[model samples]
Target: MDTTTWTLEQVKDRISKGQEIDERVVDIGQNTVVKFADNVSAEEGEATMFIARMTSVPVARIYAILRDESDGVTYIVQEKLRGEPLINHLPTLDTATRDALALELQKILNELATLDKGHMGLFGRPSQYGSGILAKFDPPVPPIESPEDFLRWLPHNVRDNYGRDEAPLPTGIFDFSRPPIFSHGDFVPENILIEDGHVTGIIDWAYAGWYPYFWNDYIARRRSTLMAFQDGKWSQMVGQMMQPFPEEFRAFQQLYYRADSLL
Candidate 1:
């Protein structure tokens, strides 16, 4: 269905009667899905368009982003890619296919990194949208001036409980000299789509942003820990897809553990 002409009210009414795909997403049709949120950010839709226009990386196309005036709900209409989440394909994937997928992921990650380091926040928006170890903010954190400022804003326990003086892993562990790069922000198996051993789509851009160069690698490794059923090999596969940052991963692990209670 061509949802290009969909209005907010029309989309809202359709969604009211659409089949729920999940809590926030609805299957308006085989070709379309809509995500609604009371506190929606334009970041996801903008990032989806940005990726489609700027790179060859496959992403779900956004048809419309509408906000209701009567109430504060926002709607994002997007293409529903014809593929299952990569997570579902893991159990059946052969060694050769897994390697091919890794190579594809590497190519995609390299393409995304080529995007200019505009600022340390959401694509086209300076405000931070937390991912990885940081908790999502209600009113997102304002544009950060420096990496140090970003670190300072992290939970005290997350930043300080590592050692003496409650210092973070190491002063220079995060090289602020390196500029932030465009990232998917979340690169777990669930966000990736695979069809016939080929990656068809990369969805969920809520955390997509310009982040520290190592952010993607770090987050992937950290997230793999939660996929206990993946046989603890997800991180290894993630390392194959991109350069692994052992030191950064170690540091983030400590931060993640300290902030685990709060999460």
Candidate 2:
């Protein structure tokens, strides 16, 4: 299970040779799992591990981070978590269990909010990853100082090209200001683990970082829409758990659509 000196090619070769692969980790036929940080930057690995260690949320324990000196890729070996993702069981849960899950998630969200860095913009380094293709503009999205700054930075041409003409940007939508808070950038059912009606862990911290207060709600709403389209009951259940921010959610939806259209 020792991959302290493995390279990206070496890891891939091992996997191709039938090494056990589970999500981000590659089981090297031993009692350990090797989580490869491929396509993710070193900073992301560092940030994820940092947040995992600091937060009370149940996350995989990091054993070590091995870097390939030649290409500078990072491989994170960590403990494999048990339990199925929340998405798999959401459909079977009754109302009471679902409510309990929601309350637990709310507590986790509140805790995450307390870990804010007091800054704005998407979390993580811009250099480590491109603005998600779904929202990249010409000048590129920068660290947001305020909601006004975020809206102002949207390229006019990009907006004109993909924006919904009927639903204009809400009046004074960006005028309001709220302090930045830590956002689990991609908080969806798939990232949450549950066993016997209790959440065991919340995984995936690649997008964990400080963002505007409304970002987490916005993301949950967006994911809820996708879930609704797939399963109405599940959608309604999740909506109840993670409330909605209608006005801001719609605003962000439009903004993301326009920005993402460019890609």
Candidate 3:
């Protein structure tokens, strides 16, 4: 909260001087700017701050937090861990490692679900989510500036070389038919912290909310779990519980839509 734009080194100095950067200390995606600060002097992304306030509990208890306050916005900051996101484990971790991490994550998720129910959507919490992905993908905002261009890109982007060919997959975006519960709006390996075959922490609560069970389902069952989703047991359960949707969406949407990591 100073009058001039501060470099990362200068801001660190202010934080050290107790200038109110808060307890947040994560420097996520330091190499990239995930958002643009509007305060005329602030940096971008600030996922750190977004994660701090979203959860009712302290980050240390279960996860680290980050806060984005320079732009008059307040949120959590989480330090990036050493290992690759949990997604990396899918390709390499042994059974014990995978199970251990999954259970740990499941445990933490269950704890989150117990928080107050009513305030559980993006509207309820001004979490810095889509902003993060936007910052990461930097998708052309304003809907691609020209509708025609987006339409032009769509066909070639897929070119029949995309989506699932499987006949029966869960369809459409997730609906909130199920009761509201705590949810990691975008729970994926990338946002998780893993160490030595177990989940060390959860990060990026920007999408935390009380939403449809299937949304969480979609994320947990995503590309990272392509093997698991296709597993006979998991597939059969999906068929029993989910409604049908488009085949093209499997790669694009089904990954997260199928996972309901409710607990």
Candidate 4:
């Protein structure tokens, strides 16, 4: 299956016909897979490939990035990785295996933390469209440089869109002066691939970017708590692997709630 030859209509049709499309990439009856990004610029696809190449962490091999001239949608062809998502197997793993997996996760996180672009903001270059929280708006918000700036930006942006006359007050005082670190914004088990008790690759780079040092740990811990019921060995291992930052976590939660209230 030559993905470069596939048209947007054909891809949509195939998807509608029950083909498995993983993160915009579909396996077109061959060993190869094609990733599609629609109604957006090519920045994200380009950034994902760039980050994959730059990082030491295992990731899918990107063969090429193609764009449809008529619609400006991007397509990425890459090697199909061989592994199951860790989330699917976590429940069956013994404590020892789970602990080993947590160690591997910690190592990956540490390596990612070593990646610093010397400034604060989102991971990729500044563009009109971004992912994660930024994608919630049209003409996406600009990458923030500081936590305080983000704190102010959140309420202002939310209120602006909601036609509110005033921004909400902060629930608590916080110092967001810490330097930014590389963050896999959506760092959950589902993004991790494993085979034979070893991590094979990490996928879904759409939300990778520069964020506060505590952001990755906080989000990962929060998700582990949610997915693992806050009592399982998986949750315990995650807590051990990543230290908790209750203050920052609470602040972010409050900000998120305040912003969500406007909607």
RMSD for each of the candidates: 3.4, 4.1, 11.4, 3.8
Write the number of the candidate with greater lDDT, choosing between 1 and 4.
1
lDDT of each: 0.77, 0.64, 0.40, 0.67
Task: Give the number of the best model, judged by TM-score.
Answer: 1
What lDDT score is found at residue 140 in candidate 1?
Answer: 57
lDDT of 2 by residue, 1-263 (tens): 44356556665565565455566656754344566544555545566676677778777766566677766556765666777788888777888898888888887887777784744544455312234652444445455676555554554435554563322355756435566667777888888999888888777676776665677778776776773347665556546655456787787777767555554
Q: What is the descending TM-score order?
A: 1, 4, 2, 3
lDDT of 1 by residue, 1-263 (tens): 56568898788787888899889999988688998887666668888999999999999989998887787777899999889988887767888998889899999999998987677777776756555545444345655766555655555433344322333445567776777778898898889998998999999988888776678888788777674545755666787889888787787566555555454
lDDT of 4 by residue, 28-78 (tens): 544556667674335445556666776778777665665788777776666
lDDT of 4: 0.67
TM-score of each: 0.86, 0.77, 0.46, 0.81
lDDT tens digits, residue span 99-188, model 3: 566566656666666666543234333222242222322222222212132222233223232332322223343332445555666766
Which of 2 and 4 is ahead in lDDT?
4
Q: For candidate 4, which ten residues in a row score worst on lDDT?
A: 123-132
**By summed lDDT, which 10 consecutive residues of candidate 3 come out lowest?**
32-41
| Higher-TM-score candidate of 3 and 4 | 4
